[model samples]
Target: MRLVPLDIDRDLGLVHAWVTHPRSHFWGMQDAGPDRVRAEYRRIAENPHHHAWLGLDDDGTPLFLAETYDPAHSELAAHYPVRPGDLGMHVLVAPPTTPRSGVTSAVMRTVLDFCFADPRVERVVVEPDVRNAAIARKNAEAGFVEERQIELHDKVARLSFCTRGAYEMSTPHLSPAAIEHAHRRLIAKALAEFSHERLIEPVPDGDGYRFGELTFRARRFPLEHWVVDPHSLRGPLDALGFIAGLRETLGIPEKLLGTYLEEISATLAGAAWKHHHRRETAEELVHADFQAIEAAMTEGHPGFVANNGRIGFGLRDHEAYAPEAGRPVRLRWVAIRKSESLFVSARPEEDHYRDELGDETLDRFERKLRSEGLDPGDYRYLPVHPWQWEHKIAVTFAPDVARRAIVPLDAGLDRYRAQQSIRTFFNVDRPDRDYVKTAIAVQNMGFLRGLSPRYMRATPPINEWVAELVSGDDELRACGFGVLRERAAIGYTGDAYHRTGTSSAYTKMLAALWRESPVPMLAAGERLSTMASLLHRDRWGDALVTALIKASGQTPAGWVAAYLRAYLRPVVHCLLAHDLAFMPHGENLILVLENHVPRRVFMKDIGEEVAVMNDRPLPPAVARIRIDVTDEIKELALFTDVFDGFLRHLAGILDVDGVLPADEFWGLVRDCVRGHAADHPALAGRLDLFRPTFRHSCLNRLQLRDTLQMVDLTDQAGSLIFAGTLDNPIAS
Candidate 1:
């Protein structure tokens, strides 16, 4: 494949077709009309930081659309440290006319070669939706290493990168010259057309430009006219005048001039294109300059506050300080402090002590201070009341001692006590187990301050409960029972709790209560199911499914089974209705205690469900309602978001396998699609949904064609048969 710079004028129809195709829903452009497409292309053509190309096979067939943006020129620069030569690239394959093996590899190789052609470009980066294993694997085959995953646009993306060396070494067969030649052709075509158009009415004012009506304002500098086609001689004008006069100085041949004007006819036909160009340009400017603009805030400040890091300052109000003891004393200095605290520790020193003291003596003094009801850990020492000073003096023992204290003596003891109490209440002794249970409980049950007494009377020791939860091998029945009992006692019935404002707060209380309870209570099965169901409903349907899978593995079998029987229908219905995708592995299922229940009934494995979707046609009834291919793709994208969120939540509760088993999860997903395709023909040609795997890269074009053909036949048969049985079938 070769990288050909996209000629908006020549490629508009093709680009529009690709974007609005049935499989393009994930990009959220399936419903876009010609007007929107034209507008989008116009904006793309004008953006300097971003370069779009049509990936063409050797036969000159367009294989994909490759768009590359320098992170330094994208909004991501604000969050990531961008190297001058780092380029962020994205490849969106055009839905193949036929399944062609190795096409993805070919396309990627071409894109990489183009990106690395510039010696200035040292690395190429991409962030693909984490669920798109096909793309992820293809990236791996193309020499990209999986970096840390990042959340972008509320979805997790596998951020992968390829250094110039890696790209060059990985694909020995790639021809850089071929890709460059193709790109130059496309770019030259665009430049020639652009130059010719400017020659006539060469100077564009707001009213005369294509899509000008849609623009917020006319182009400010009209820099293209001056630089692309310069006619010298009369050159003493200022920047603006020189720019405006370029049109008169430059002349285009008449034959080529007509071609340029004709190329923009499609764009000029739509008002959306007019507005799109200006908005796109504005977006580009904002994205490119965001980091610089943000940095400007610290221009006169003491030091730069990195993104998400803290800034500290002090405001001294000397007027508020009072020397009198009976009256309230206010300190003049008000300090504002901030820190990332990610790795830093805050250590307080008692160096100014009442007298000379060694480290051991200081430790003893600190213990003594604790015994005397003074918190040595206190950091904020502003005295708010006169009584606070009295408490401070009592702790210090003498005026001389108080005067020699390094930390402030006027701080409020009551404030410190209250702060410590609050902190203690939130801290989980068994963080892994208690934290998950509490978060789940809170998500399902509203927090009530009054519940503290009930918890104190009935909850088991927090450490024991946490140990049991994290053991990871606990039977689903037992885990479910425990979750149910705790939630039921706290009046948390499920999604109902999430509706309450006190959900998060209540969860914290539940954790504390669980740790302190004297006896462990195993909840009834129904209660566990209800709570699990409620948690699932709080977000996207797939999210709920993933959560339930996790909950099933961690909770007792009886509780999980009972919960599944009671709540599975709602969860399943939601998943089907929303077209949610998830990994249905065996571990994801919690086996119910009932002997009559099917083994699959309490299925804990997310991998299983993912496999079911492969080559699988949506049940006829479901397919009728979800036949809009674009909508299905969009739903898949949403599923990716939901899956990521579920994993994040699970990370707090489960071990490594629970947090991210990327390969296993993606494998199940691929199986599901493949299996589903076996029975459905309509899904046969849709490569847009399933990205090619790394191993699939070795398949010859003919083999790929045959495989896709068989899958399509299967999909068609399943979908058609199902539709035939339906009373009413929707048309594609």
Candidate 2:
């Protein structure tokens, strides 16, 4: 294969046919005629940031369409943090006129080489529509790491990137040894996580713990930092079959079992995606930033086995929109009838959201509704995940649309970027606007990640209650903890015709909530970064943590102490003082920084993640925050979630990078908890309830047992699965 200029006039005839093929779903040219195709390519050729090319076979026939551009200059709208030397690209292989083998791969390889031929290009990025699994697989073959799904004008494209070094070392096949290693790693993770969840107990068989069967028939490495090392695994390594066999044992329903398996397969596929690339050393990722560190995050959550199980997403979907893809997306909007929908506002009246949707934008929406013979006042506008709107709503909720109960509208005005969770978006164009969390029915890591319509009614009050508590508590204010309230929530219950059933997806289909932006809360010299990004490393193995420590001129221990004061201290405070717990994982929390050093913490995703264990509540609006659970299970919100789930992994990185030692890491966390107790004497009794050492809680068990609906919203804590125990390093 070789590079050839894609002459718009000459190629338009053949390109149109290929793009219009039913299989070319992501190309978005189904309705385009010859002239339209020409105009599109011509625009690409005209733009300075973009170029159009064709891959030609040995016989000199064009095999595919390729477009390359500067990502910063593209319509991507900066959904991602644009770095220097980033290139954006897209390709559409000419439909196979006849049975052919390796043609697509060959075309991709050529396209890759062509892009890399430019000495200035550091990485090649592309966003194929999320449904294009074939192309996604091809991208992995070309050494691409799937970043996340981004929204473009027309489709939800999977964002991905490839480095010349990674692509040059890519292989088309995996050796048996590689497959064995991958399988063992998958099974090993499953064993540890599932067993921890109490879903399956592994018996001592020969040398190792066995679950469901003797495949416990494996054994080897000892625990490192109180966590299982997957590489030491050896035995029957069928992750899918293992989970399926445990269906009844795990006590999951059959309907969810199928979805569970699909998620597992997708997780395995993600491992396979990285299999072809030359693995980057932890030392390098420690130094890298943006896409570099994100790429190194091949392991999802260490506690979950099928961490990346985005089931509804095919390889293509995974490529385009997975949070890791780091693509910018513009959410689709719809006007839902006020009678069938609900909007709870935290700001006076609906001014918060009204100001967000500028008067000009609202005027446009009103004109659109009026033109359709509908009244704007009777509707509440909800932003829908572009993927959910395209794949589910257009067809599933067509009846409501026909009746004018749900009116499809244009994409929102501002360009928004996806946060770690694919459905939540931060407006890059208008950073001060409240962050919008929309419902996406696509099932990923336990349950369809849809914002619950039934739950949205109580969200504002829950957020307000927490925000009020944080503000009123002088100690919490002194600790610099901030809670970004979900200012407003809106969702449609659906009209009678569309009210077919209240399945998880249907009920969540048209819901959105706006979280207060941390931008407005930042101090004069402060900046914002997702706490998850602290774990980010630059391409050179430089730790953002190390960088922060250096910038602060603090010892590694002191930097950690500051971080704990901002993040971990508040978590401990919420639990001890108010019987409140926030999911303190990387993605859900944001850290305010002063010259890249920690300053304060912000907690988000209040509607679902925030929970109060006891039923001691007075306000009816905030009563929903309470969840029933045993005292033992309540510790998990801290022990497992904050410590084992988040800190353990971060410690591993700092330890492996030699920037911080493991012992000192655990010691720091212990000091933070102990300090909080010492400072707040009134809560001394409550603080004693949180032990340094506790049982190991399992997250993947719930996901494995049921990907469709892992936990009951009504009984969030009661749904927990627990097994065994861990010798907490923080134990005093």
lDDT of each: 0.34, 0.73
Q: How well does candidate 2 match the true structure in TM-score terms? A: 0.70
What 10-residue stretch in candidate 2 is worst by lDDT? 218-227
- TM-score of each predicted structure versus truth: 0.24, 0.70
Instruction: Locate the minimum summed-lDDT window of 10 residues in model 1.
Output: 298-307
Query: What stretches of model 2 exceed 4 Å from their correct place?
Result: 1-188, 191-238, 241-257, 273-297, 348-350, 497-504, 533-553, 613-617, 628-636, 656-661, 689-695, 724-728
Model 1 clash count equals 72
Candidate 1 residues 1-732, lDDT tens each? 567888877887888888988776555578888888777767776888887888876447878887888788776676568887899997778887843333455466668778887889999988887877777767876689987888776568777788987865553222343233222222222222233223223344344332111111122111111112111112231222222333233332343333222222211211111111111221121222211111111101100000111011001111111110011222111001111001010112233221123355446546655665656554211111222223322342233233333233222111111100011111112212211111111010001112222222223222223224323422323223222112111211122222353523332221112122111222233111111221121101123333444444533233333333332322232233334333221212222222222122222212112212233454321232222344333333322222222222222122222433433333333344444346444544443334321111110111112211212211322221110111100011
Residue 256 lDDT in candidate 2: 74
Q: Could you give candidate 2's per-residue lDDT for residues 474-500 as a string of tens digits? A: 878998998899988888886542366
Report residue 100 deviation for candidate 2 (angstroms).
34
What TM value does model 1 have? 0.24
